[model samples]
Structure formats: structure tokens, C-alpha cells
Target: MSGDAVLDLAREGIWVMIIIGAPVMVVGLLVGVVIALFQALTQIQEMTLVFVPKILAIFVTLLLSLPFMGAILSGYMARIADMIVTGG
Candidate 1:
């Protein structure tokens, strides 16, 4: 493939990664922010307090979003594979 085709594939790969990861990351960020706020308001400065809830929240979100994530990834992979086969 040409340089432009390679670059296009790379860009699509990055976008797929972002799309696949965004929901879980966004959920974790929201949870972490809320937890941080709570800790600040309560003056509870436990170092470990930040991790467990975020982990659980992210896990739960992943579970909930698994099908959607799988579909997106599958579609991207299929498109990429097709592009490769067609020498795009």
C-alpha cells in the first residue's frame, strides 16, 4: 500500500481504539471525580479509597457495554480486513 493508505489505516485504528475505550474510560473518570469530591468534602484522605470503586465501576460498565464494544470492534476489524484484502 502507499503511504497515504498506511496513514489512513493507522488513523482508523486509533479512532476505533478511542471509540471502543471511551465508554469505560468516561465512566471511570466520572466515578473517580465523584469519589474525589466526596473524599475532599469528608476530609477522608485514604490512598486506597480511590481505586476500588473506580475499578468496580469500570468493571460494571464494561460488563454492561460488552456487546456494544464487541460490535464496534468487530465492525472495525472487518473493515480493516476488507481494506487490506482490497489493497486500499
Candidate 2:
């Protein structure tokens, strides 16, 4: 393919990656900030307190978001397949 085509594909790949990862990252960030604030307020300062909840929250968020993520990836793959079939 031409350089422009390659670059377009690369850009789409990067955006797809970002779209897939954004939910998990955002959830984890929000949870971390809340946990940090709680720790600050209560002065608990326990390391596990911070990690366990964030991990669990992220896992749950991932589970909930799996269908949407799958759909996005599947759509991208389908597009790529179509492009290949069309010799683009």
C-alpha cells in the first residue's frame, strides 16, 4: 500500500487501541483518586487499601465493558478484512 494508506491504517490502529483502553484507564484513575482522598481524610495510609479496591474495580469495569470493547475491536477487524478483500 502507499505511505498514506499505511499511515491511515496506523492511525486507525492507534485510535482503536485508545478506545479499547480508555474505559479501564478512566475507571482506575477515578477509583484511585477516590481511594487517595479517603485515605487522606481518614489517615489510614495502608497500601493494600489502595491497591485491592482499584484492582477489583478495574476488573469489574473490564467485565462490564467487555461487550463494548469486543464490538469496537470486531468492527475494526471487519474493516481491515473488507479492505484486504477489496485489495485496498
Candidate 3:
């Protein structure tokens, strides 16, 4: 592949990675902030308090987003395969 094509592919790979990870990251951040606020308000200060809910929320978000994520990845893979077949 030409250098430009390689760079473009690399850029696309990074974009796809970010797109796939964004939802989980956002959910984790929100859950963590909410948990932190609750702990602050309730004065719980439990070290592990944020983990469970964050994990659960992330897990559920992943579950709910699985289909959409799969479609995106599948489309990316198809494009990669086409590039390979075309010797791009």
C-alpha cells in the first residue's frame, strides 16, 4: 500500500477504536462521578463503592450496545477485507 493509504488506514483504525470505546468510557465516567457524589453526600468513603456500580453499568451498556458495536466492527472488517482483496 502507498504511504498515504497506510496512514489513512491507520487513522481509520484509530477512529474505529475510539468510536467503539467511547460509550463504555462515557458510561464509566458518569457512573464514577455519580458514585463519587453519592459517597460525598452520604459520607460513606468506601473504597470499593464505585467499582461495582461502574462495572455493572459498563457491562449493561456493553450488552445494550453490542449489536451496534458489532455492526460497526463488521463493516470495518469488510472494508479491510476488500482492501486486502484489492491489494490496496
Candidate 4:
């Protein structure tokens, strides 16, 4: 493949990664912020308090987004495989 083709593949790979990860990252960020605010208001300051909820929330989000994520990943993989097969 040409350098431009390689670069395009790399760029597309990164875009796919971002698209797949964005939901989880966004959920984690929102959960963390809410937990922070709650902690501030209640002054609990428990370490596990911060971790458990975020983990659970992200896990739930991951579960919910699994199909969407799978489709995206599969599509990317198919594109890559097609490129490989066609000798691009």
C-alpha cells in the first residue's frame, strides 16, 4: 500500500477507536462529576464510594452499548479485511 493509504487507514482506525470509546468515556466522566458533587455536598470522602459507582455505571453503559460497539468494530474489521483482500 502507498504511504497515503497507510495514513488513511491509521486515521480511520483512530476515528473508529474514538467512536467506540466515546460513550464509555462520557459516561465515566459524567458519573465521576456527579459523585464528586455528591461527595462535596455530603462530605463522605470514601474512596470506594468513588470507584464502585463509576465502575458500575461504565459497566452498565458498556452492556447497553455492546451491540452498537460490536457493529462499529465489525464494520471496521470488514473494511480492513476487504482492503487486505483487494491488496490495497
Candidate 5:
């Protein structure tokens, strides 16, 4: 394939990755922020306090978003497969 085609594929792959990962990341970020705020207010400076909630929130978000993520990934895979088949 040409350089342009390769670059386009790379760009699309990156976008797909971002899209698929956004939900869990966003959840983690939000949970971490809230936990930080709570810790600050309560003066509970425990290092481990930051991890569990963020992990649980991210995990729940991942579980909830699994189908959507899967669909996006499958679509991307299909597009890549098509591009390969059609000799992009």
C-alpha cells in the first residue's frame, strides 16, 4: 500500500483505540477525582484509598461498555480485513 494508505490506517486504528478506551478511562478519572475530593475533605491521607474505588468504577464501566467496545473493535477489524482483501 501507499504511504498515505498506511498513515490513514494508523490514524484510524488510533482513533478506534481511543474510542474504545474512553469510557473506562473517563470513569476512572471521575472516580479518582471524587475520591481525592473526599479524602481532602475528610483528611484521610491513606495512599490506598485512591485505588479501590477507581478500579471498581473502571471495572464496572468496562463491563457495562463491553458490548459497545466490542462492536467498535469488530467494525474496525472488519474494515481492516476489507482493506487487506481489497489490497489497500
Candidate 6:
């Protein structure tokens, strides 16, 4: 592949990675912030208090977004395959 095509593919892969990961990461961040706020307001500064909810939220987000992620990955793979076949 040409340098330009390689760079374009790399850029696209990065975008796909971001798109696939954004939902889970966002949910996790929101959950962590909320938990931190709760801890602050209630004065419950337990170190392990943050993990469960954040994990659960991230898990649910991933489950909900699984199909979308799969579609994105499949589309990327198809493009990669096409490029390989075409020797681009």
C-alpha cells in the first residue's frame, strides 16, 4: 500500500477504535464522577466505593453498544479486506 493509503487506514482504525470505545468510557466516567460526588457529599471516602458502580455502568454500556461496535469493526474489516484484495 502507498504511504497515504496506509496513513488513511491507520486514521480510520483510530477513529473506529474511538467510536467503539466512547460509549463505555463515557458511562464509566459519568459513574465515577457521580460516585465521587456522592462520596464527597455524604463524606463516605471509601476507596473501593468507586469500582462496582463504574464497572456495572461500563458493562451495561458495553452490552448495549455491542452490536454497534461489532458493526463498526465489521465495516472496518471489510474495508481492510477490500484494500488487501485490491492491492491498494
Q: Which candidate has the top score in lDDT?
A: 4
How far residue 66's Cα lies from its native spot in candidate 6, in Å, is: 0.3
How much lDDT does each candidate structure score? 0.92, 0.94, 0.93, 0.95, 0.92, 0.94
Report per-prediction Cα RMSD to one decimal: 1.2, 0.9, 0.7, 0.8, 0.8, 0.6
RMSD of candidate 4 to the truth, in angstroms, is 0.8
RMSD of candidate 5 to the truth, in angstroms, is 0.8
Model 2 Cα shift for residue 72 (angstroms): 0.4
Quote the lDDT for 19 in model 6.
Answer: 96
TM-score (C-alpha) between model 4 and the true structure: 0.95
**TM-score for each model:** 0.89, 0.94, 0.96, 0.95, 0.94, 0.97
Over all chains combined, what TM-score does candidate 3 have? 0.96
lDDT tens per residue, model 6, 35-88: 999999999989999998888888888888999999999999999999999999
Off by over 4 Å in 1: none
Candidate 6 — which residues are off by over 4 angstroms? none
Model 3 gets an lDDT of 0.93
**Candidate 2 ranges beyond 4 A from true positions:** none
Cα error, candidate 3, residue 47 (Å): 0.6
lDDT of 2: 0.94
Clashing pairs in 3: none
Q: How do the residues 5-57 of candidate 4 rate in per-residue lDDT, one tens digit apiece?
A: 99998999999999999999999999999999999999988878889999999
| True-structure Cα RMSD, model 6 | 0.6
CA deviation > 4 Å runs, candidate 3: none
2-73 per-residue lDDT for model 1 (tens digits):
899889878988988898899999999999999999999999999899999999999999999999999988
Which candidate ranks first by TM-score, i.e. highest? 6
Worst 10 residues of 2 by lDDT: 1-10
